[model samples]
Target: MTTGQRIAAKRRELDLSQEGLGEALGVSRQSIYKWESDSSLPDVDKLVALSRLFHVSVGWLLGVEEDQEEHISNDLSPAQLKLVEEILSRYQQSSQLTAEQQERVSELVEQKVRESRSPRHRRLRYGAACLALLLVLLAGRSLFARLKELDRQYTDLANSVGNITYSVNSQIGSITSRVEEILKSQNSLVADYATNIQSADLASNTVTFSVRVVPKTYTEGLEILLHADTGDGLVDVPAVPGPGQEFSGQITCPLTDSITLSAVLVDQGTRQTQLLGNYSSLYGSSLPAVGISLLESALLNIPRGEDGLFHVRENYGFLTGLSASVSAVNEDIGQSQVKQVQLGLFRNRALLFWLEPCSRPDNHHGFEKAEQWFHLPSVELDLQEGDELVFAALVTDQYGRQIVTPSLPASRVEGDEITWFSTSFDFPSEPDGWGLAG
Candidate 1:
């Protein structure tokens, strides 16, 4: 059906007054009258909105049959095309305009035609010209009406589209914020879990320490220490990484004793420290898999005294005489005292047989070296009740030859607070002295 017929039919089906339809479409009642009378058309974009409102196609609105092409004529804008379709569909099922409105549109067309006569042309020419002018006026009126309708449709559609876009953007933003929040929470959870694990493990087990001494160069050596049972016992292991080299050894308990695994790397001149396979397992197991782990790894700096030499007597007092006598003339004279005395390393084995005298005052010939005894001035002692007493003595004879001797059984009386005297004597003494009387 034609767009006008469709509008008339839809108006009848809806039983709507011309005024009612005009109000819904946001147009003047006169405009609706003109549309149903076939004097004008709606604009293109309005046509599209009308099609959505009434559910149909522009071709059907334009009165094209099913066999005809569905494309609208070029004269129609997108809105007009849609309006045409809505009018058609509504006309077929629900006429929404009044009979009086249609009749009024017809009267207006006729009145306009009558006024068009003029003296400027022949009757035929004037009629034709008048007809053309009337058609032009009608077309212009239709165009204006369609433009108005489309303006209203455009505003409403734009508002709907903007609402949809805003909703989509809000949803997306919310999702992103939630994801970020979850990630942050997860990170905090992981950190908390790690801390808990560490605290739990420490509380559950006993801590033992192992040390690896590594020397960066030939001058550097590795020292490993273990802190076991709350620092009650110490083990000094015997593995060092020399300078410019690397070495590894297994950490055996009681570090003072020997271990099974050992490795040494030779360097040109400088010592170096390196990792080895055996020590790798021992150190690695210190983590979760193994109960034992190293608290600190470093190159140990051994103090000079810890080497177990250099002793001073527990009692520091002025000496009356430091002496020992040997019964055998040709036997080791100073061996007992030299062996008992503690010094730097060991008794100078080179002086294994030389006789030397210690510093002293009372001279029976200005302090002679006995094949037996050499004395030192008594040194004073600020010893506590259970303190240890120690000293080194040398014995020499007139010949100034080296000799060894056995130590006497040291004695202590009650309330004396002097005991635990250990002494050793060696057969040969270096120029200075041999052992420590530790």
Candidate 2:
């Protein structure tokens, strides 16, 4: 029966009017009307509450089973009563089980009789004892099922909590690493600007650069040395005291010569090598060269696929060509400009795009721009693992210096590509702010 019909039937059986039932259940008369009219389901908690007040099992109240008026008291037969009395006597002295629990005990006894009886006699004598056995089996099965479901629920809860904690911790670690990097870069810049030049020029007469290695954690008594490449071979710059003691030095070189400097961080605590970095230049020299550069240090390395197998999803959108250049503005101060960069290609919803014009002509800071749009035609990209796409943005400083993020580390383009798979498609028009002419 529908929920509405069941509610109405139950009310009639109890001889209660809609208003009386509503008042008893702490609901308005209209709520009673709504329940009887099938407008909505009663809340689960409210249903449980009503079952208690009416002294009826929730299953029977919900019309899952019939309410037997003839068996209102549910008295047992002579034999059944005798067994029940025995079960109760035994239970009360040890176990405090209710009438329901006794029903389970009756089934257990009936099942034992069935198991020991002959096949011919089993069919005929399948009486009260057999009934009791059925009840016990049902009770045991129901309890088992409920326990299993509870176990599953608890496992799900634990996994969900673990995932949340892991995500939170990962975010915190990323933020801490980024902040530490910024602070170290700022400190180096400050030292370069403030420290007095100890000597004019030393060693190599090649392209001049500086390598700064900042420890994730502070350590005492660490020394840094610079490595340079002469035409014959590479040589190490003289050892210098680190910034831990507030020490700094200067080195100058020729324009054509190439050199690299590695920072070997020594831990005074354990007297062991703490960290070893590839030779990197903070100035003039480019990165990913014969030696590593500062930009490499800034990049967060995402491990690539080992087997070179990657699932590539279909491109259900458009690929717009790079059209215009816009200046990246500093969000802090509107007038204070930062970098000039170029816009990379874009797809519908800006799926994949590149940002160029990273550094200034002076090479001080990177660029930032807000709310720029680029328009392009719909195109499908069938990319594989290890395939890279270059993105360029415009970074124009006060001096009109244009810089771009190097092409070495670009977007790794790949997804699951299945041909003959049908997908819905629509074309997009150029919006007002984004266009080929703009």
Top-TM-score structure, candidate number: 2
TM-score of every model versus the real structure: 0.16, 0.25
Where model 2 places Cα greater than 4 Å from the true spot, the runs are 1-153, 160-225, 228-248, 251-339, 346-369, 377-391, 394-438
- Tens digits of lDDT, candidate 1, 1-438: 446556544453353544566687787654554455443555444444444444554444454433222222223234633543343233223322246543443454344333323223122223223433443454455444443443454344444433343333223223322543463344421111000001111122222233333333233332422112112253334444433343333333321111222223334543322222121111111111100001001101211133332222221112111223322111211111112221111122222222233433244343232222333222233333322222223333232322222221121211433432222122222223334221
Over the stretch 1-438, how does candidate 2's per-residue lDDT look in tens digits? Answer: 544555655564464555567788998755665565443446655565565566654455444446522112122234533543454344333433457766666555555444434343332123333433444464555444433443354344333433333333223223423543454455432222121112211122234344444444444655544444433365555445564554334444332212333343445644322222122111111110110012211112333234443333211111111213311111111121333334544332232544332222333233222123323223345445434433233333343322222211224433432121111122121121123222
Error in Å for residue 321 of model 2: 20
lDDT of 2: 0.37
Model 1 ranges off by over 4 Å: 65-438
